[model samples]
Target: MYKKLLLLLLFFKCFAGFAETIRTDVLVVGGGASGVAAAIQSARSKIKTILIEPGPWLGGSMTSGGMCILEGNRTLASGIYAEFKNHIRELYKPRLGYDTTTNAPLVFEPYTGAAILKRITDTVKNLTVKMNTPFTAVKKDGTGWEITIMQSGKAVTIKAKLVVDATELGDVAAAAGVLLTAGFDSRTDTKEELAPQNATNQIQDISYLAILKDYGRGIDRTIPQPAGYDATQYACLNNADIKKMLASAKLPNDKYLINWSDCANQYPITSDDLNPENREATFKKAKLRTLGLIYYLQTRLGFKNLGLTDDFKTTDHLPYLPLIRENRRAAGMVRMVLDDIYTPYTRGSQLYRTSIAVGDALPGQHYSIPGAPHINYPPFPAYSIPLGAVVVKEQENLLVTEKAMSVTHLVNSSISYPSVQMTLGQGVGATAAYCIFFETTTKNLKPRIIQGEILDFKGMLMPFADIKTTDRDYRAIQQIGATGLLQGIQKPNGNSARVLFMPDSVVHTAEIKPFLNEIYSRAFLWFNKEKPGELFTIGNLLSYISEMTLRDPKNLQDGIQKTWKTYYKFTTGFDATRPVTRREFAVLANRFFNPFARKVDMSGKFIN
Candidate 1:
């Protein structure tokens, strides 16, 4: 009996060794655009990283889905996404004669974009790219995670400290049992201007995109008729609404993106496409619908010569995957709503301190249910993406990227764009690295620390053209603006009144009184009696800072005097009537944050 028990122990130990094991500091699942960025950033930080992509290629919708044409302006694209665009320009500059000086090389072929991603990721020393591998299961192994992935019909186990769900559909989040929501949210649920009264399990229709080759003139290139092809099913193709949508969907290189409003293959009715039960059948139906759309374009619209391009060779002429607009969004620590984008953050709010990523894409219209209210998002300025939106609400050691992020359906439409997704990915990667470096959880890591890391990578937490890098108090001013303490008050500038943060502009008592009241809750009632156009004084600035920070006015004054005596040689008596310039206010503000500083610089004294 003793011999038999020893043999049993040996057998179990041997089995454990036989199983494949891979270890890394960060394991990013789903090699989509965000996943690729996350893996690159994490590995570049010197962490052992493993990136698993189910598809053979990288660049999710940005590449395989044939979304090569970049969206948003050059100001919006920064960090890794900007680097990727620059690399693409380098690859095609000789071939296409695109000007390297300008940021106009936003368009590229599908294969070229994918190849660029592959080549760039291959150069990272600590990153391991596992192609054609899908995440099967994940469980908490102590404070970390042990993930099971299926690669070539064999299961491989990977142990990692951090896991990011960069899947286009939030697969890893679901597998980890993270709190998630799907479909449309009600007005009561999110208080959004356009959300319906009652929530519904309906999402924006996904498109099976096809890149068409423009073979100028006429030539017979009609594809075989798709199964169950019907003529009456697409009577709305000629409608005015569809014609406008088609015009917007047109791409360069004589190619037309076929997914348009009220026409072709946009599946409006919500079905089991996201449900695991009927996923396969739903995918087939979607593919057939696209094929039918092509037939309509050729036979009905009289474009017989236009043939489908063989860009995605793996999936015939169509893209390797469908362009999914919405999915199960993980409930994060901070859920981003329309207000966060359309309006500015309130002063002294936590949201202001945590702004990490920035995006400028306008929200796209949602057409999940027929006859649903077609809500439109008004044009807004570029906004910051808070770190709370990426950290999972309840789950530990996990972060979500792409459409799975914590945002309302309306905000999702804007952030779902590949460029924005990459920004969020880079932020997440940096946050993950910080968490690993500091030996802290995502919940415990502060946003300011993460923001510092993002800035180090040349990321734009706030990408305003007016905010230059050379500003003396750039970081402090950015922090203030981020908190919505002082928004750009619109002033007339000839033809248009553009809102701008004129940092050099002096602040008057009238402008600062209302903000002080908002922050201090009417603590200093005497400020209401100040004269109009009176310049904010040094004494007023000190009192306001002391009150805002809940410090005793006399104590703060004494500390400031003592610090000034230690730092400066020619300090006389305190002057209360001296007008405080913007630069002086910045110095006082900086000192307020770091009261223990032994030395103070006065370079900003010349600033208005």
Candidate 2:
């Protein structure tokens, strides 16, 4: 008997050396919306937490995903949601260049966004955040979960008491065999009016959101029609689905609920949504076509195709990655419904005591999925959120994030807005952190207690500004205000105005100087450049930028050269100091985003 027991022990011990175990109190996956918040909260709780993001940049939708607007969290939506906005204010305020309007500090650049996230996250303890580490697979391991992570071309195993799947597509939960519902569940799985009866695990449609850069003048700023660009030769651009909006020109804008006239240089430019199953055929085709759409429009009409402008006149083309507007949502314990926003709750009772975060996103009408209902926003009084929605019903170990979470289809349509989701993301982030600190599941937390924790973590739950005019830096203008980048308030007289922020207004080198200095962008190089005071030409800027910064200067240089040689070679250029419009730089800006690149900066600081 003794010999047999000793042999068994030896057998168990034999595998120890090769285990390569990474033990953490909390393992938060996907560092976009929810994961970032969750990881930050976990670390702030002073518990050991590891954040694994498949992408290079941390700000999933806002930065790398390039969806800059804040979503969800309203006045009634407090907790972790409030804290994220506050961080934006505290960190990005001073760096916002002088605002032409309220002059509130705003950070328009994407790379700057990454830097901000890095700064806030680096301050936490027992937290290891690694990019390009996608969670490949997951499995149940008794009380905890065993997570497999792929990083730098190798697979590593991790053991976490709590695992948060803040992945963009509810990856881990699905991999772990969690029961989930995808696409718009009309009456089939859910009694949602906007859903279809055949909603059989069909996922909601995902679209790629891209930013174009048009520097006012230059042939390079223009888009040469796609290889087959022809007014007569129409395919995807002329598809009845998209053409339906094209005929109305205002349809896409209306569905998005934005006055496009105010978007400045903003126009359509995208590749394929990264999560698309047909990445090579479909996604790649979409990206080229997005630019081609602008090219067609420009060639048809005598105009240019400008890229999305974060700050500075430089071309910021395709989004570092595709924006997954909607994805697989988990089946949670107590799903949130649209009616729940104005809950049919007993007066003194709360709908959910596990309130992890808050939001106020009213769904827009973008019908990628068939039979999607058109939703109009009539202000529902801002409300609170519970932790039940964060827990994957079948798999208690995972938490859904980004565009994926548990919500009644109708309810999701409302909260699915970009601004509101950010708030919700923060809430779950705090929940993950709390669970790590207390060593418990989010299911066990009380909403009031969670609220307290969120407050303690310094996240605020404030209502929408009576005067809302957040700039490129978002609420960041208030945080970095000391640098004098911002002038006065978010809007003139500190009141909300009918202002459509022009994307191009933020891109001046003069404005960037303050941002670069405040964010610690190679101070030595800032002063010691061979091409000091050169015009804001892509060629000129690339010439002196630190090699460390331009990990592959030649590649970026070649793109710019090709673009310039092809387009901008003849157009007049803008003065780096002068304020310009997106329409002016339309051509050059349109191609800034790469087809497959995540962000322009190799350092992972989000590029504008």
Give the per-residue lDDT digits (tens) of candidate 2, residues 161-249. 88877776667776787776655565655544444555443333444454444345554456545564445433333323433332322
TM-scores for all candidates: the values are 0.80, 0.61
RMSD values for the candidates in order, in angstroms, are 7.3, 21.8
For model 1, the superposed segments whose C-alpha errors exceed 4 Å read 1-19, 92-105, 239-254, 269-272, 347-350, 366-369, 463-465, 468-477, 483-485, 488-608
lDDT of 1 by residue, 1-608 (tens): 99999999999888875567877889999888888998988888777889999887899987878777665534456678878888887776785444455435377777888899899899999899998888888998877899999978988899999899999888888888887887779999998777888887778887777888768776878999989888776777755453455455555466666655455677664634676666667767778888888888789877787789877885458898887878788999878887776555442233534677777665666473467667754445566788888889888879999889998877787788888888778888888888888988876766666777776776656645465444545565555554444555544434223335666566677665664454445545646544434887767877767655779988887777676545532134456666665545555665574321211111101111
Q: Candidate 2: where are CA atoms >4 Å away?
A: 1-19, 71-107, 187-205, 227-280, 305-317, 344-349, 368-372, 376-380, 460-608
Candidate topping TM-score = 1
Query: Of the candidates shown, which would achieve the greatest lDDT relative to the real structure?
Result: 1
Sliding window of 10 residues with minimal summed lDDT for model 2: 251-260
